[model samples]
Target: MAVLGCYINMVHPVQAERRKALDRFKEQIRYARDFGCGIIGTETGNVHAEIIYTEENFKEQPYLDVVESVRELVTEAEKFGVIVGIEGGVNHPIHSPIVMKRLLDCVDSNNLQVIFDPVNYLTPENYMNQDVIIKQAFELFGDRIVILHAKDFVIENNEKKEVPVGKGLLNYNAVLPFIKTNKPYINILLEETKEPDIIDSIAFLKRIYYQTV
Candidate 1:
């Protein structure tokens, strides 16, 4: 069964009520572990701006605040004995896979892992580089990929958009081969599930996916 690792903000920035969010985050991770959810991932940081890539005053990418926030998540994740994968998305400056690499290298925490979503690194001008992007991601993250945001993406009118797994620019069939070669142990977590129904998502992956016979 696909475990829903809630991507919604687990940590509310009500600095006064720090324990509230921390306690909730702990409960969710413990829930994941109790249910045998092999891995879970989430964004440890965000910007207040409405725009996806727009830089904010204090919450810029590689924000020190993010590191501090992750430290808290790390402490909670230890009890569940689950690996917490820190993701790089449009809302973050750690947009590239290499930034994920840098964070892993810097903190050197055994409890943290990578949630590879290669298309998040795509810029307007560099939209045609999914092949390069995915390859670079595999090279950088390698076996540390704990989970995959298994959805392809596109830039339409400069806004990021999600298309189906096999139909869009994601090249899921080929992409999975590379990911399997580099990080076979990691689960291909489905994200960007554009289908309105959960059943639709299962149909999509059943048609084109990485599996062993």
Candidate 2:
């Protein structure tokens, strides 16, 4: 089944009145489960919790709440028989994949897993051990990976911008061989394929994926 993710803002800093937003996120996942998808993925909190090892905005509440949010969703997702994957992405507050592993350990839900896209963490400002970073992520998350995001990055305006997958430096076509070798049945979710070309990209990915199998 194709995995679809939604950032329902399960945990956002909306004072206290908007508390219902978290439940709404859970409902969205329940609906996704009804549609026959085995997994529903989510991005971490909008504020990069201190997990990235940056001293900026390193507070205890956001750190504790992000885990609580994942736990709540995963608990409900288990009732629906759907797995939940928390994505590690670009510009995310919890940018380090290793910190993500630690958070996963704290939640430790049966329905919880990882959805990864390594290039999302890539930034031109700091090369910061890219290969070792990826290898370590796989070492920690290989077993829990339930979905992959197919996004590529390019340096633009001094920051990474999303570009079409095959056109960018990140290697989706090459990554395929590795993913299938490790986790043969995991779903690959494509993002940021311009509206005009989404159909083509999905079709192209299917062709390449099947050819390898």
Clash number for every model?
Answer: 0, 1
Model 2 is weakest, by summed lDDT over 10 consecutive residues, at 48-57
lDDT of 1 by residue, 17-57 (tens): 44565566667787876677756667644454233445551
Best by lDDT: 2
Kindly provide the TM-score of model 1 when superposed on the true structure, using C-alpha atoms: 0.77
Where does model 1 exceed 4 Å of error? 1-4, 8-14, 17-19, 49-52, 57-62, 194-213
| TM-score of each model, paired residue for residue | 0.77, 0.80
Report the C-alpha lDDT of model 2 over 67-113, residue by residue, as the tens digit.
78788888888888888878865445456777778878998886888
| lDDT (Cα atoms) of all candidates against the true structure | 0.64, 0.70
Candidate 1 displacement at residue 6 in angstroms: 3.6
